[model samples]
Target: MSSLVSFFAGAFIGGVVAYIFSRRVANVQFDNAKTRDKSQKKRYKDIYIRASNQRLSLGPYIVAIGGGTGLSTLLKGLKCFTRNITAIVTVTDEGGSSGRLRQEWGVLPPGDIRNCLLALAEDDSSLNRLLNFRFDRGELAGHSLGNLLLLAATEIAGDFRKGIEELNYMLAIRGQVLPVTTESVCLVGRTKNGSRVEGELNITTCGPDLEELWLEPRNAKPLPEVLKAISNADLIVLGPGSLFTSVIPNLLVEEVSNAILNSSAPVVYVCNLMTQPLETEGFSVWDHAKWIAKVLRRFPDFVVANSTPLPQDIASRYIAAGSMPLLVTPEEREKFKKIGVYLIEDKLYKINEEGSVRHDSVKLAECLVRIARSAREREIWKESIQFSGMSG
Candidate 1:
């Protein structure tokens, strides 16, 4: 009993010391973050030139269409490579904290869009802090300050795209972000084998049996700017998001899919790290590719796959949550090979001690630049062949 008492006393003292140190560290970090924000404003003013000041070049343009964390994660990295980027995000989400805001106010949910904007913002910028600010209590306890700002802007501007444009200006964001559709839309999903699910969150987490997903607003129109962005892009990126919800919803717009097929740009699909039980249940990387291609009138020119193996410990945690790392199948690789689609193999995931699988943004972005450059070479080759044939 005496030994046990002494051990407990020692542990308590050590824990108390650790807690105090942690709080002090946190305070220091907060101060540093504030200082960083102050300096960023001056930096942007010095560097970000107006359209007239920008150098004119016919360089490649990239359009990334999708919503949710996956798409934002990709954007966080992609922006590092090229300044000409366009993100066409989904607005059909109506669940969780985002759902409550959508109900209380008849405006597009701001959760996903807010995330995309922050992802494109300069690291430690004040704009990111403002956008991520959340209420601490009351009816707005769970609402994000950014969501309220977006709602106010949408109502005042009388246009959702215009609202985002203003926010972009304030943030000095690197890329352009647009909604998939302007009409308020909801996601409705049905299981592959059976059952119907409604609402984006419900459909995404309901089960591993989803067969198809559709938007509620059947007459929803694609934003003209989104279509224009796609048509002029030199490359388009789809996926690395909820296969149906984030990815397919954008493609569901007839004009959006048509733009992909018609554009003289390479299409690349970034496969997910794992299958979401409620959405992509039982899907392989190839299954995801096939389903997305089904929606696209033309197939992709390149596919980026996680050649890295996920840690078993992290996999166990995911299994407990009813999800698993998406495994690539041999047949799928062969199929892609037959179709002339190049598969990029790389270690892009880092399983932290906390058991969360995060995309190594730097690695993924670096890989994207290399692959994109290679795709450009291939495009040159194809165009050369066409010219040669014409001469013959």
Candidate 2:
């Protein structure tokens, strides 16, 4: 009876302790549940806000390299997501309106940069018409309105970077427009026949095919900010511009390539939709990648290439001009894969009524936003990273 009493007393004490511990555990679980619920609600709200402000986040240190309308078009798409796009445009545009401006003003080439800025400008700004308007008569016959603005601004600021800053505010632009170099840069092309051409336009006239295109000054200094932007960019885009004049010219700047090679950011090359006659005649997807990779010292990680085929009739039209459809064959993809280049094949071609290739701006923009968001997610661990969904 004494042993039985002892056992019963022990069992009773044990049960009491168990009951207290269980109550404490239950209280903690309940509090935790409440906290989780609160956190979930807050998370949902943040997602909602991010979705609404999706475009705004894209405004952080995004840099675009290359020149011409291709670079400008990309800027148009990028600006939709974030105002923070910095364009390091090529000044080797020695064609039509741009060429004339460079010759007459004795100023840095501003035509391509001007177009890029206008593309990023908020709608209905005075900066638009003022910069793009054309003159029909006078000594200024063919000069674009934007080129004049830049020239005037350059003169006033006594610096190209300063002019771009002033214009950025007035236009409510998302980022700064920087020249590849403040020094006057001329495009140099060495033909397969051993003939050397001195200007971007001259290269077009010189050839059935190009051997190599380089920059004069051989030691062109890259804009300091351009170098900084490349160093800090989460992403760098090479182009859909003229392969020789617009794209390669920037890379030829020794400092520009060095900065890009040093950056931890992924470099994406937006391949042109159509082959250009003189510069990239008969060039294929792999051809473009090979040339660019070799020149820049490292192949691009991602190539956003066009997979859409041109209509036979349109293809014929291009063929007449000695241009070929840019084929992204399996072999071509493999060639790129041999290097660090990965292919992002998508239908991003929009042909104008004039039967010329154009960029699918909306699709391209969507791709860029997706890339940025995914990159951010990977950078920040899920425990704290919140994604802003599409606002539109």
Best by the lDDT measure: 2
Residue runs of model 2 more than 4 Å from their true location after superposition:
1-55, 58-60, 124-130, 206-209, 353-355, 379-392
**Any runs in candidate 1 off by more than 4 Å, and if so which?**
1-59, 124-126, 190-196, 205-208, 351-355, 374-392
lDDT of 2 by residue, 161-190 (tens): 788788877777767788889888788877
User: Lowest summed-lDDT stretch of 10 residues in model 1?
Assistant: 383-392
All candidates: TM-score: 0.78, 0.78
lDDT of 1 by residue, 1-392 (tens): 99999999999999999999999999999999989998898678767644313531223477888888888888888766676778998887876667787788777878888888888875636766877788888988877888888878888888777888888887767777888887888878787767888877787675456666677766678888888998878678886788877888888777788878888777888888888875677778877887777778556777777765677777888888978787556777788888877676667787657768977776776665554555566646323322111111
Task: Candidate 2: give the clashing pairs.
Answer: 55-81, 83-174, 131-145, 131-146
Clashing pairs in 1: 191-211, 192-211, 207-277
TM-score of 1: 0.78
Clashes (backbone N, CA, C under 3 Å), per candidate, total 3, 4
Q: Report each candidate's C-alpha RMSD, comma-separated, in the order given.
A: 14.7, 16.4
